[model samples]
Target: MYPLNLPPAQILQLSSQLLCSGLALLLVGLAAAYGLEKQLNVPTLVLAHSLTLIGPSVLKIGYVLRLVAQQRLKDETCAHAIA
Candidate 1:
């Protein structure tokens, strides 16, 4: 089962990693596509398209993870205040 109780720090770390990696992938993909468009080779085209598609999805997930981490932190703070 997926762990929902990850520490906020860990979650934030994962989120940052995903965000950075996704941005890198997106940039590389766009670069490859624009830089290699004239060639139109099958492998290049596939790699570019795949990276373009996967990058945004990873970015979106990272954004969601960040939000989740923030919420968890808020909850922890509220719990502490209540106690």
Candidate 2:
């Protein structure tokens, strides 16, 4: 049997922790935006909420692209070594 080199359950647990933390951060951001809306106005609140929603997505895309690049480099190295 080919050994499956997946991350262990503990890593999954840690990931769940990170997910929860992200959710908490999103909630806090929304609350802050709400407070700002009351203090300032609707436009500022919209900007804050948009940033809060988009920022993490942008970060995740960057991380995924980096991983893809690393994997491509490794594949090229392996092909060169084989040839």
Taking all chains together, each candidate's TM-score versus the true structure is 0.90, 0.54
Give the number of the best model, judged by lDDT: 1
- Tens-place lDDT digits, model 1, residues 1-83: 23467898899999999999999999889888888777879887899978988999999999999988888889889999999
Q: What lDDT score goes with residue 39 in model 2? A: 83
Mind giving the per-residue lDDT tens digits that candidate 2 earns over 15-55?
45555555665676677687666785777777768757865
On the 0 to 100 scale, the lDDT of residue 31 in model 2 is 74
Model 1 CA deviation exceeding 4 Å by range: 1-3
lDDT values, one for every candidate: 0.89, 0.58
Q: Quote the positional error of residue 65 for candidate 2 in Å.
A: 0.3
RMSD of each: 2.0, 9.4
